[model samples]
Target: MTDHADLLELAVEVAREAAALVTERRRAGVEVADTKTSPTDVVTEVDHAAEELIRDRLLAARPDDGIVGEEGDDTPSTSGVTWVVDPIDGTVNFLYGIPQYAISIAAKEGDEVVAGVVLDVTKGEAFTATRGGGAHLDGRPVRVRDVVPLEHRLVITGFSYQRETRVKQAAAIARLLGRVRDVRRLGSAALDLCYVACGRADAYVEEGLNEWDLAAGGLVVEEAGGRWAQRPGVGGKRLVLASPAGGFDDFVAAVEGCGFTAS
Candidate 1:
């Protein structure tokens, strides 16, 4: 059996190492080498470099483990463990020198994520969790906020890079705006989820995110006493809704009431 605690420790270590590399490269200056999906979606040489470093370290520590990174091909594993990684979760923000980007890494057994970590590179904060082990920030235990009423809760969300999808997303946000205390759009999904996990925010909703984007942060939120659900969205996309226990039902209802569907 895999030791989830050990896996969590490895995740935090690898994530911090990757974050260091990303931070160093950003400080030294690197160019945006290419775009993916749309012009608004971008990749930098540092992204690739950081991913390579992460892959190397992971494989070095556990040669039998598989890896699925945002910037590279998947490597199969025979040990029943797969590492899901996003070397730079907010590439656009990284390119623009914004401080909100992060390095996200998660360890999965089958379909369940057993351990995860999200390192806010600029802020030097590490959010981590293990299956059933609760969540932590910089070595201190953290839990979701206990806000009860949905309307009083602060919510965070993100936009899709595709213009058409973003248009619809904006509309949905507009409908939800009046129901919540306020809404924020942080460029990084991983960070947004961590914010919900650590009581920085009450909830988060976003559509069109890949597994790598949610694998780590989702686990953190759940372990921090939060509820998260991925719902079906327009064009076969996935929408993620996460909130504290008190407002979970109302939040989900409000999301669907605003014309969003949960899977």
Candidate 2:
């Protein structure tokens, strides 16, 4: 078995490398090659290039390991380890020159994630964690905020690119807004989870997220003394909610009241 620490290192390294590639490409300006699911769901050449760079580095380092990436076909592995990667977590933010985009990577052993990292591309902040080890931001340990009332909590969330889903999601948000301190849509699920982990936000909830979007940041939140739940959403899709230990139940209930099912 590979050491969790080593896996964490690999995740951080690969995520950072991919983030650098994305940053350079954005600096050079790239064209949108296509859209997925909807016209609003955009994809650029940089996304593919970054994913390829990560795949190449990971396979070269551990040929037996598998890879599941957002922009590429899944590769199976003979080894128990499989890497989940999102080369660019916030393509819209990246396209708009927003600094909230990220490169996320995680190492899963069987069904468990053993290590993970999320690199804030523009900020150059690396958030990392290993199972049983605490989460960190730029080498300093981080923890979720302590007890806070549901109404006082600031929540971060994201919307689906599909207009229909976004409409439903926006309606849900409207109902949630008056119940919480405020709501923020950061356009990046990975960073939203990390913000919850590092006390930047009191909670995060969203649907229509892929495994790669949550895998890395989820571990960070868990290790930072937070709890999360993934429940069945409309159309069998999953909705994720993460909050500090003391505020989790209330946060879950608040979102559930807005019609987000909790499992």
Candidate 3:
């Protein structure tokens, strides 16, 4: 039988190790390794190094499992399981010396994510979850916050690297701003999802997040009693929208009303 909790343990371990490596490298300073999609969408040497380290450690522990990562080519699955990883989820923040970046890792059995972890590098906090198991932060059980009114809920979001897409997002956000208590652009999707999971924020939404970016943190949100959904947004990129259960429907209506789903 596939042990989801066991997979969670392995993911947490690998994520922590990667976090340590990332922190050490950040202290030495960062250099731009390349750009993807646009000049502002940056990747650093530390990102590559951290991903390599994570791949090595994970493969060493589970040789037959497939691996997919932000910075590395996909390894096909042979053991009916795969790992989706984002060695550094907020690379732009890392490059700029911000402390919000994280190492996110998740285990999937077939198409379903069975286990996951998101490690905050600078904060040393690990958010973890397993299918059928509740979510946790540093071993403490966590759940989304209780009822919050529409006008008082704090929402977090991120913009796409594409300029045209961002222009649309800006307009959507402007519409959303009046409906919520406030908004935050934290530059880290993984952390943003975890924040929603743990009640740090009432909700989150973003477009253009890849599988590696959503796998771990999405699982965390579901396990924390929150609801998340993705839909085709502007330019056909995914628009991930999530909120605590108490106000999820209200939140979705607000998002759609804000023109987030308009192509």
Using TM-score as the measure, the top candidate is 3
**Cα deviation of 81, candidate 2, in Å:** 0.4
RMSD of model 1 against the true structure: 1.4
Q: Residue by residue across 117-190, what tens digits does model 2's lDDT show?
A: 99999999999999999999999999999878888999998877777777777878899998989999999999
Cα deviation at 101, candidate 2, in Å, is 0.4
**Candidate 1 lDDT score at position 144:** 96
Candidate 1 per-residue lDDT, tens place, 181-204, comes to: 999988999999999999999999
- lDDT of the candidates, in the order given: 0.90, 0.90, 0.92
List TM-score per model, in order. 0.97, 0.97, 0.98
* TM-score of candidate 2 against the unseen true structure: 0.97
Predicted model with the maximum lDDT: 3
Stretches > 4 Å off in candidate 2: none
lDDT of 3 at 169: 92
Candidate 3 lDDT over residue span 152-261, tens digit each: 99999999999999999999999999988999999999999999999999999899999999999999999999999988886469999989977888898888889888
> Comparing 2 and 3 by TM-score, which wins?
3
| Candidate 2, residue 155: how far the Cα is off, in Å | 0.3
In model 1, pairs of residues that clash are: 231-262, 231-263, 232-263
